[model samples]
Target: MAASRMYLSAKRAAALDAELMSSGGFSLDQLMELAGLSCAQAVYKSHPPESKRNVLIIAGPGNNGGDGLVAARHLKLFGYNPIVYYPKRPNKDLYNRLVTQLSNLKVSFTDDIDMAITETDQILDAIFGFSFQPPIRDPFVHVIGLLELTKKPVTSVDIPSSWDVDSGPPKTGELGAGFVPDVLVSLTAPKPAAKFFKGTHFLGGRFVSKEIAEKWGFSLPNYPGVDQVVELPVDNEKL
Candidate 1:
């Protein structure tokens, strides 16, 4: 039987991540590779490439964006068309290689998100992750506006774009109003905000070991067989 799941706070989430890399001996690239691959597998299993082929991945400038970059590469290998819209990029070499890998795969990238959205069948909201906070800014401010206006199914990575990691969506503003994604892929473990998500929820990043879970004071369900991702039943849904 799968273990009972727990929702982690933003502070604990960051601490667990640090422990995974520092003490667990997992490299950043290794973790991102696992995360992005799991994300690709989850999306493929749920949406399928035959129906939702063209994916508009709105990547941000953080490690969250790096995950998207890695996901784009895997999605392509899975026979889906992935187009990336990375407005602001980090100066790190890891990010540079991710972009280069996507470019080498002949994946299309666009500066005009409007045009990209029009052409794509679905959207991947890899714009932000667990550590995000408060008021939106720059290109993303406009990007979030575009995402809200769209009818496309948005698959958010870790946390939905512009969402508070623990408090969930906004209260009285347009920042995250009615912006619930069609699919939510929670990495490592689900965040406290995941309670707000009503869509098909998937738990990926299947690398959490017994030690890490113990250290973090959390429990995680096992991934079925050799699968890198697993569909989690929302109590409201499977009941």
Candidate 2:
């Protein structure tokens, strides 16, 4: 089947997520693992390991960050030197376990985002997901500013950091002030902001049920063969 072109608003996305967790026979951990693995696969597919093996993953304080940590583990196994810059980590046991897993893999963690950005070949923006709002908070505001200054290629996890899930970025004078990712791995379903993303976009999260998709009007792309991540066409005209 062809991929669905439907885009979800932030509220609808959250509702679908809740419904999936409650009745879709999948746990949060399972979805996160799949999403993270798909994201790693997307990065690996986009930038060959022979050329761009040094990846810097910027994690936030939510499940999105946990996904990045999981991606870090998989990236390490995939022969990529993934350095994590997690300024704020959540206190949940699930997140702690993810950190432990990364430590077990001996993945390097850095407090310096700028240094990591300077050294790495590619970046994974796992800082925020669909629930983020504007008026950017503390250290993240500073971090986003630094990212805006850099020219390195970035692959955002679910949604680009500081981007509104329902609408695109705030209509300030600077349209591209924040981190503009070269690739986007949309978990579960693509948010409305994705329509404006002019990059190689991929749909992750393979656990969503047919019922949920139909009910929520999710136009999902079909994953090819054994691949877990499928690239979607970007509307370059919108860029």
Candidate 3:
């Protein structure tokens, strides 16, 4: 499939962002919109024809969480039941806007990850945007534990919460290098962290892929006024 592709690492993802920003004539908000809408469409297509799932989106306070909220709103429009789990306090006005949109749409909200896990058929991880770092803390650690227990299908936006995008390794005390998301979605670039780090201790497989491109009906790279944008290398194995 056309979507069977790969992207760059978190640093590369950041580089792409910088490239776009330096090019000018576009704002980061626009990119966020594309990521969110694209994610929503991908999740919609992944479900079965008769599937009426209770989708749970776990979001942090960063842009990653924002993307998850965007997907939740779209999922609601697509007739699926979507609930958003916000683990941390939102720090940005844009994040506030997302919360407001969710409220306006009447999408259910929760601060408790455990509650969300119990209720959801599909889990979307928007927590910890990218660059999985050291020291797993309170709620995030709790959420990861819940993810381990649930074993439900999970789709991570950008990168999995516990996996370092560049190394694809788990954080401290994390047995593996990263979270084992059934599907890891990359917005504009592939995360190199999903590759490079391979060991018996590591998950040692593709942590990135573009399978959503075909499923979500993204025929062309999405830019506001452009027919097509730049094309990078496809790292299917990494995804």
Candidate 4:
């Protein structure tokens, strides 16, 4: 209910991140850590450790990819075998550190996306976040096409890959080009594209300051007990 009332655009989300880091004293690394951990927790809650323990994480070259990398590490710790498929890795220290962390955890990296998809029970769509734009390029285009062919359930972090931050999914003839996630984990707050999501949705990122929430008019949801993630009720009519 509170999530439905607040929909952050790409610009607003960026501003919130900046404000949080500059004034709130939260580092980018800190946010990414919490975000990725929350995503892993969501997957663990949905599938559990006893069932469907294998996950395929598709990471990109941006902050979203970093989040995926972080999620892979946490997933491994949670007793799930997570394999990462990072075609385009960023040259930043943070990303490199994440890759190293995953490697240290013995999480293998796969070059064959199709094969990895077949072996895994669930897919983590961390290929793109709120910053992703239009006509998908290169290896990602091919990779996304392969993912579309699978019947496996996908859980997207922040926003679904290939989706417009403000306009939801891109039209592919009569259908949408983006991968429709079975579960969406929104970090900090729900983005505009989340309006199109019609599945289990969880709101993460508990580090947002009260000042930031009031300033941006973000309605924070209350997590039950000691849970790090809160499930939001989906509105089929809106979808």
lDDT of 3: 0.63
Model 2 Cα shift for residue 181 (angstroms): 0.9
Best by TM-score: 4
TM-score of each: 0.94, 0.93, 0.75, 0.95
Tell me which of candidates 1 and 3 scores higher on TM-score. Answer: 1
Error of 4 at 36 (Å): 0.2
Judging by lDDT, tell me the better candidate of 2 and 3. Answer: 2
Clash pairs detected, candidate 1:
none
Across residues 169-215, which tens digit of lDDT does each residue of candidate 1 receive?
Answer: 87766676757788888988888788778788898857989778777
Residue-level lDDT of model 2, residues 74-120, one tens digit each, is 99999999999998887888999999999998998999777888899
Off by over 4 Å in 2: 1-4, 174-178, 236-239
Backbone clashes per model, in order? 0, 1, 18, 0
Q: Put down candidate 3 lDDT per residue, 1-239, tens digits, no spaces.
A: 13343445566556556655665344767666767776766566556324747899988767888878887887888788899888676667888888888899899988777767876788887887765565767777778777766767787776667776666656566643435776656655445554432211111112112353333233333333321122222334534
lDDT for each residue of candidate 4 in 1-239, tens digit (9 for 90 to 100) = 44346888999999888888888898989999999999999999888768888999999989998989999999999999999999997788999999999889899999998789988999999988898876688788877777667788889999888888888877875223746779999999889888888889998968876777878987777888877799988744455
Candidate 3 C-alpha error for residue 95, in Å? 0.9
Arrange candidates, best TM-score first.
Answer: 4, 1, 2, 3
